[model samples]
Target: MAGIYIHIPFCKQACLYCNFHFSTNKKLIPQLVNAIAKEAFLRQDYLTETIETIYFGGGTPSILPTSDIVFLIDEIKKIFEVNSNTEITLEANPDDIDEANLVAWKKAGINRFSLGIQSFIDAELQWMNRSHNAKQAKHCIDLIKKYFTNYSIDLIFGSQLLSNEDWLVNIKTALSFNPPHLSCYALTIEEKTVLGNKVSKKVISNIDNEKQAQQFNILMKELAIAGFHHYEISNYAQPNFESKHNSSYWQSKHYLGLGPSAHSFNGSTRSWNIANNALYIQSIENNNLQIETEELTTTQQLNEYIMIALRTSGGINLNIIEERFGVTILLELKNKITAWLQANHIEQKNNFIQLTNLGKLYADGIAADLFF
Candidate 1:
């Protein structure tokens, strides 16, 4: 199955730690929406298979008017074979989750939501310069549960201002809603972001790796008790509630991405639209796509497979690797991972190799080491 990702590069305000490509200018909303719809028509043949998922990712898709969202969906349906049960998700912030918008979103064919509830702590929310307060974060869940059964909330851990006790309270507060899915991410200070600038100027302390690791352990243990499956390293889901769009990404399924800074991937080639919204609109108007294309080399593909699969619960399938690559490559991969196996960092079952609890801490490092 295939999927579509539409990047709405507009936001009300920039978060302190965000490094994503987005503008705070709401004036470009109309032009951007029309451009995205045009892009869908232009790239119709990117995926041959029926579309199973459509994700409206951000800069806060909920910030748009409901009518615009409906129009985009209708435009896509006109050109693509969208599955009747296709999972359509929109990313939202707590402040935008009013009854009016929620009802409108449901009516516009948005079956799921990914709420950006970074933390339920007022102080932490302030530190992150989030648009919503702690009260809004907690209150929005009740409103959301009333409408969408398949929704996910995002939480961040490892901020210097967040204590272990505070982190526990945040987790408990989110669990109180019993959300179908949770995506917990570590707070990373990316360059060019406000937090990154503060750290460089010594305005704030650097992140504590030890503290982050401790919080991750707490998240895993608590979520497991609450019956959430840790399907991916950063994602947890209740039974049958996994993110179909993201799962398709991990499985290397073909997907078409529209709008500024969005990416697309078929099996052999990958492409991304220009990050500048003005440039994107201009190019679309000129009937030209401002995108860069790359045909992945065999080694590049194998390395990518290793990186993605290793971070997942499925780990790396040796037989699939052997079948797709070669037996020689599989043997070489096994030999490369012998050290990690001996170190008790990874365990192998009949045909799958998965990271152990201890190994998960160094997942990126291990995955890099195993890359072809």
Candidate 2:
């Protein structure tokens, strides 16, 4: 099954730690929505499989009008083979989650929501420069619980304002809502963001690695005790409630991504659109393709698979590696992982290499070390 990702590149305000391709300009919403719809029809033949998931991610997709959301979904349905049970997800911020909006989104075919709650502390929300307050966050979740069964909460840990006690409180507060899924991320400072500039100027201290690691361990322990599965490094979900769209991505399923700065991948080639909104709109209007493509070599594909699969609960499949990359390379991988195995980071169970809790913390580093 294939999936579709639509990026809405507008936001109500800028967050300190955000580096995604998004603008705070609301003036271009109508034009950008039309451009996105046009691009969708233009690239209708990009995926060969039936569409099983449609994810609206962004600069906060919930900021769009219900009419815009409906128009795009209708356009997509007319051009593609969408499944009856397709999982349609919209990433929303707490400030945009009023009851009226929730009702409209439901009618427009949004089956799931990924809320950017960030933190439950009022001071933390202010520190992050989020548009919503603590009360609004709780109220929005309450509204969602009444109407939606499959919803996810996003929380950030290791922030300057969040102590270890506050981190525990944040996780427990999220669990209080009994959400089906939770996506907890560490607040990493990117060079291009406001937070990064503060660190670079020495206005604030850099991330304390030990403190961050401790918070992550606390997260793993708390979530495990609460009966949530750590399916991906940054994602946790209850049984049968994992995000189909995001999971499809990790499994390397074919998908079409529409809008500025969005990436698409089939089995062999991957492509992305222009990051500039005006430029992307202009190219679509002129019927000019503004995307760049790359052909993945065998080693590149294997390394990519190794990087992604190791972050997941499924771990790496040695049999599939041998089949796809030949026995020589698979033997090399086996030899490479010996030290990791001895260090009690990763363990092989029935030929599948899964990470221990300790391994999860250094997952990315380990994946890079194991790359071909």
Candidate 3:
């Protein structure tokens, strides 16, 4: 099944660790929403299969008027073949969620939510420069629990202000709500962000790799005990609540992304839109798509597959690799993973090779080592 990702390139405030393409100016929001709708129609023929999921992501989709969100969904439905059970997800921040907004979002056909509640500690929220305070975060969760069942909330571990006890408290707080899905991410300072600048200037302490690793381990252990499945390296879900849209990406399914700085992928080629909001809107209005495309080489595709698949709980499918590449390539892979297998970093079960907890610590490094 295909998927659609609509990037809302505007936020009410910028978080310290965020580097996503967004404008704080609310004046252009109306134009931006219209531009996004236009882009959806422009790229309607991009996907061949029926759309099973539509994700409204970044800078803060919940900040938009409910009417604008419904307008975009209606536009997409008119132009594309959307499935009856399509998973429509809107990424929301705690501050934007109120009873009225939740009711409006539900009316707008938002069946799922991805809440950005980075931390439960007020100090941690301040450190991250997140818009919402701790109290508002909890209050929103309470409101959401009353209205929605299919939702996921995000938590950032390994922040300078968070201790292990604080991390446990944060996870426990989320567990107290019995959320269906959780996306726990280790904070990594990306370039061009305020956090990155702080690191460069020694204005703030750098991320301690050991501390991050410890927190990751803590997250995995806590979630597993709480009966959450570690479906992906960064995502955990209870039972069948795993995000279909994100899982499609990990499985390399075709998806069309609409909006500035959004990326689209089919079977062989990938493309991305221009990051500038004004330029993106201008180009769409002018009926000239501002995007770049690239064709993936066999090696590039294989490496990409290895990178994504290895991060998942299903691991790498040897038979699929053998069929797509060759038995010779598969044998080489088996040989390459021998050291890791011996070290118990990875384990082979039937045709699937999955990572062990020890291996997960070095998942990226191991995937790179096995890359073509």
Candidate 4:
């Protein structure tokens, strides 16, 4: 099955650590939405299969008025063949969520939410320059429970300000809310972000890998004990609560992405729209979209497959590799896996190779090592 991703490239404020393509300027919101809808029709045949998921991710989709949100969804439905039981998700910030907005969002056909409740601590919020405070973070969860049952909350761990105690509180607080899904990420300071600048200037310390590893271990142990499935490296969910759209991505399903800075992948090629808002809108206004694409080579595809599959709970399926890429590649992969298995970094059972707790900490390195 296929999926659709609509990028809403507007936010009320910029977070200190965010490097996403978004503008704090709300004046371009209408044009951006219209541009995305137009792009949908332009790329209508990109995915030949029926659409199974529609994800509204962005600077903050919840920042949009209910009418704008509805218009986007309606436009998508008109242009694409969406299944009746399609998973429609919106990414929202805590400050933008309220009873009225939550009710309106639900009514507008959004079945899932990925709330940006980065932390349940006021200090951490301040450090990140988040628009919402701790109280709003907590209150928004309450409102979400009242409106939508299938929701996920995002939490950031391993910030310099977040001690182990604070990290525990953040995890426990999310558990207290009983969200169906949780996506906890270790904070990384990207090169162009404000957090990165601070690190370069020594105003704030860089991320301590050791502390981050500790926090990740805590997440695994606690979430496992709490009955949450560690479905992906950065995601946890209750039974049957896995994110269909994201899972489609990890499984290398085709999807059409509409809007500036959005990426689309068919089985063999990858395309991405331009990142500039005004340029994207202007080009689409002229009935053209500035995009770049690359066709994957056999080796590139195999390496990508190994990287993505290794990060998931299902791990790498050797049989699929043998069938698709041939026995030679499969034998090469098996020989490499032998090293990790001997090091206690990977466990093999039932023809699947999955990361151990120590392996998860070095997932990227291991995936890179296994790359062809």
Output the better candidate (1/4) by lDDT.
Answer: 1
lDDT of 2 at 192: 97
TM-score, each model?
Answer: 0.99, 0.99, 0.99, 0.99
What residue runs in model 1 are displaced by over 4 Å at the alpha carbon? none
Error of 4 at 14 (Å): 1.3
lDDT of 3 at 291: 94
Q: On residues 262-289, what C-alpha lDDT tens digit does candidate 1 reach at each position?
A: 9999999999999998999989988999
The numbered model that scores best in lDDT is: 2
Lowest lDDT sum, 10 consecutive residues, model 3, at: 39-48
Instruction: Arrange candidates, best lDDT first.
Output: 2, 1, 3, 4
Q: lDDT of all the models against the reference?
A: 0.93, 0.94, 0.93, 0.92
Residue 362 displacement (Å), model 1: 1.1
Residue-wise C-alpha lDDT for candidate 3, range 1-372, written one tens digit per residue: 999999998898889999899989878889989999989888877888999999999889999999999899999999999998999999999999999999988888899999999999999999898999999999999999998999998999988878999999999999999999999988989989999999999999899888889999999999999999999999999999999999999989999999999999989999999998899889999999999999999889889989899999999999989999998889999999999999999999999999998889889999999998
| lDDT, candidate 2, 1-372, per-residue tens | 999999999998899999999999888899999999999889987997999999999988999998999999989999999998999999999988888889999999999999999999999999899999999999999999999999999999999889999999999999999999999999999999999999999998999888999999999999999999999999999999999999998999999999999999999999999999999999999999699999999999999999999989999999999999999999999999999999999999987998899998899889988998
Q: For each candidate, C-alpha RMSD in Å?
A: 0.8, 0.7, 0.8, 0.8
Per-prediction count of colliding residue pairs?
A: 0, 0, 0, 0
Q: By how many angstroms RMSD does model 2 differ from the true structure?
A: 0.7
